[model samples]
Target chain A: MGPALEVKDLCRGFGSRRAIENLGFSLGHGEILGLVGPSGAGKTVTLRILSGILEGTSGTASICGISVASGNRKIYEHFGSVAENHPLPGHLNPFEYLQLRACLKKVRDGRREATCALQACGLLRYGKRYRIGQLSHGHRQLVALADAILGRPSLLLLDGLEPRQLPAVLGELPIRPAVLVSGRNAAEMADFCQKTIFLDRGRVVVDEKREQRN
Target chain B: MFNFFALLTYEWRRISRTSDFFSAGGLFLLLSGLLFLFALLCYVGKPQTVSPFAFWLGHGWPMVLLLVPPLSADSIAGERSAGTLDGLLCASPAAVLLAKFSALLLHYLLLWTVALALQPLALFLASLRLPFPLWSGAELFGALSLLPLSGALYLSCGLFFSTIARTQAQAMAATFVLLFGLLFGPSVLLRFLPACRWPILEDILVRLGAASQNGWPDRFLNFGTVAFYLTATGTILCLSAVFLRSRPFH
Candidate 1:
């Protein structure tokens, strides 16, 4: 009924170094938008700011019309983020990690939810016994994906996922969370996203729908 | 509160499985035991000078303070380095820091219990005399009060570093330096500075050490230590929350 995520002139910086500045975008419900940019293009910062993990120097961000900086728990409850560098507790096996995440997201039937997420991410066999540190980098990436989806969040933020992992979302698309994906490859962006927003040095350079690219 | 407890439980389970926890706990036990054995041997030939129970209690408590920050230094910093901190920050920063502090508190509680068990056993074996328990119920009470308060202080300091540090190694290094400076630097400085020869300055320095502070070990079980810990923990936690709220994660 409304935009899933909205950013108005979002600006964040680290002292003299500007990480993100005057970034503005909006995604409608069920829309999958690709964010294309080079390294240091402020893609990750934009995602982090939208997810309420990082404070913006100036600007406003909202998830489903709720201000993120206002400590609105409801906004976080509806959001999910998977960064390029997988951030999972190394001591936890996939199952325990996902289960804990499910609980935090208030997912019903946590064990079942964990199993489904693991299975979807191609990590079901690892189960509760496979420590995160033992997993390969790719598998670790999948685990992060599973965690992001565990709570069935309304808006999903994914950064720099490889193509093999793209299939993992096939089963999740029906639930249709608004997906914002950031990647360097245009082909990969076109393959998974319905629209692409090209960012260069914290400013949007190009915005195109998938059909328009064709 | 339930979210806070859940986050704490999650961290406790995670920490229990890590090499950091096991190695720190094992190293503490080994080193403390070795030091106690050496002291006991020294006392064996000259029994009039030292009470092993009192000596261990005196030395052991301060050692606990020195050990806690290192053991906890990586708790949050490691997460950030591993990129797990962002997911955690998705939850309330207050909840995240509190959970970490609670986990470290649980860790120290377990360590304190081990210290409790080892004290009597070490005295019995080394002294060859049935050990006289130096911790009267009041002293025991005092220690109980001091443990969490001090542990929380250490954790709060660790969490602050975790937020500021970009890597686990940096966090560990910073924590060690801070702990050494806070716990030992003052005494070292006072020893060299003739200006600090006054009884008041000496008393202040001693009070900083957990063992020398009679108020800590003797009155540990009292409400004062509890109040002090609660207030200290609350203040640090609030500071951590504010820092988290103010800073950009990247």
Candidate 2:
């Protein structure tokens, strides 16, 4: 596996305190990278920068050769992210929401792709039955997960999923794309990730390499 | 652009399916109903005061001017507030703005079509004549053109405010202030001031065109006002795009 995404000295801050400083890492294609840190370890911030929702104060974050800050009109086409408490439109059922997302992503057959993504995330059953707002918290998370993967984005970023928290759909998250999963638990990160990076304050404290997945 | 149209369709479905038509849209519909009712009331005895053009001149467009901000207030601000703007970041800010405006403008046009049609519909039932060629031919053209032009202007302002305001209510509030200022400011000020003594001042307002009286200037000024409205609308949309791009992620 090789790097599908790379971050070099990424730094972000509000007024005074730097929330993330001198952070550096690379994610390989087909690799599941776990970002493990305590609360405020800047996990969410990093993902935001990569998703181009938040610009970094300094340094660069690029995914699949596309730089987040590059002003590339198609930059977002390559990446999909599910943020913590990601707000899905409450008015739309999960299937409708996915179809809308597919249209936005310009998928060739939007409805079909949406259905496949729902099935992949193990939400096809529930997604068809209820609006996202009507679903349980776990199911909503599943819906969000399904949305991100629907277009088969080359890079996927997910924030705030507890380790193995999505029991019904846990094993269904696609494994081929480069994925960055952020959480607070070390044991949890270690369970699914081939490379687990620990952060304290704003810097990477450890990057542990584990046995390759089967 | 394919990218732009895709977003437009997505927005259209989302809005219609979400039944957004019932919120501010429904309110505007109710107000339009009131305009027709007022027309009907005026028509009962004083048929002379009620023309297809009369009701619109006296009330219909003004009602639209007053009520559309609430409908448009959420055009962009809602997306930003929901943190959904990032999803569309794959396109340029201007492209997104265009698509968003197109979707919202379609929504506005649907409402306007229904509301404006009521003027003619009422005239037909009340007077046995259709409202087309409402005014004289030239005047009719001017009247017809003004409705959409004014709509584009207000919708543009709302889009700009939506881009800047942090919340939907804030967007609507700020847009309402600006809308009323435009609606009431010049006419009220021009009427209130003894400035009528100044020929230049009166000329400016007259050229600006009248919401009162059969009140279009010549064809040139009528076209000019439409041009001015379009320029203003385009300028505001451009500013919003710049502001949207310059702002750090919400």
Candidate 3:
């Protein structure tokens, strides 16, 4: 089988500022890769490009061997994304928000999946009554994580989630999905990631397997 | 169809629950009530009897037009500022814009309905002194026709502003400026020009401004005017969707 997600020669720029330059990476099925970089080092930008939220200036990305440029709805259906700020509709409670995501993803057994996802994220009790805006920052992060995992997407893209929240997420992340997470802290990146790719000024500076790093 | 409804429902819930929505709605109600009371006092205080209720109804719809746009100004722009555009871009850009526009249109419709409901209360108060037709069924229907069209026009403009704006405040300000330009700016310009110059310049400006071409007050309901507004709205909405899709979210 092909890699779960493949990005080659990804270049994205905003006017004079280059967000990412020739960023090439691939993830195998069920692999967890940590993207480590400083602020403005293009980690979030790369994740945005891969998740189909942002178009790169040049290069190609394929999800499950299907090119994103071909208008592959299946690719999006199989992928989940969580950005730095975790922007949920502030009016919706956790349960309503997850349920809406499940419907959008066309998940089978949506209610069951949403409930399980929330419970796994330790957010089941706050499920029915709490709006996203009312939730604490850490809890909001968890909600976004739950949204990413609820549909059991084959590929997951996460940015700016702290290490403390990682335990709640990683401990219960669904199987068969290749996960890519980005952070500025190398220590936190090293903790959960099986492989680490360090970036500097929009280019890859380090790529090491966890075992090699150890 | 299910996806469309689901998106619409989600948007409605999101917008209606915002602090901005409540504040705007409350302001509209307060202003309308004050205007009604003022009209009543003026009529009773006058030597010649006038239909205070009819006067209020005449002024009500135009005031609604002024109010609705501000309520919807930030509909899409807020999403962009909050970094939610990335998540929304996961869906088809066309669908997202259409769904948001529908939600805004629905919000204005509800506001219009509330304004319409107040007409009866005004009429009942007027009935104590004189017999007057406060609202004819035909007039009500006519005004309703224009409400959706005008609301769509404002919403399309707002959507375009949201696509280009970097911040919520900027988007809101742009929306107000555009709306004010469309509604009152032409009349203000006409006031400065002489009558001979006004005829030529006013025609051109009104056509360009998306104003009702038929006449003032009653002419607001003409089919051609409604079509013109709707067509403009559709064109702007299409442009906004394309712009949003082209840029994506980064």
DockQ of each: 0.49, 0.45, 0.53
RMSD of 3: 4.4
lDDT of 2 by residue, A56-89 (tens): 9999988888788887756566777888998777
Give per-residue CA lDDT, model 3, range B11-112, as digits (tens).
898888877777777777667766766665565566244332235344454564566555555667677776666666556778888888898878877876
- Model 3's CAPRI class is medium
Clashing pairs in 2: none
Q: How close is candidate 3 to the true structure, as a TM-score?
A: 0.82
lDDT of each: 0.73, 0.74, 0.75
For residues B41-67, write the lDDT of model 1, one tens digit per residue: 665667555543245455564565567
TM-scores, one per candidate = 0.81, 0.84, 0.82
Q: What TM-score results for chain B in every one of the models?
A: 0.75, 0.80, 0.75
Which lDDT tens digits does candidate 2 get at residues B170-203? Answer: 8888988887776656676676668558876665
Best by TM-score: 2
Model 1 stretches astray by more than 4 angstroms: A11-22, A172-174, B39-56, B120-127, B130-210, B213-221
Q: Give the TM-score of candidate 2.
A: 0.84
lDDT string for model 3 (A1-214, tens) is 9998898998999999998999898999989899999988999889877877667899998988988766666676778878887777788899888887777677788889999999988999899988888999888988998988877788888898775676666667647578889998899779888999999989999999999987
Candidate 2 ranges beyond 4 A from true positions: A127-129, A162-175, A211-214, B18-20, B23-27, B36-55, B119-141, B188-214, B220-222
Order the numbered candidates by DockQ, best leading.
Answer: 3, 1, 2
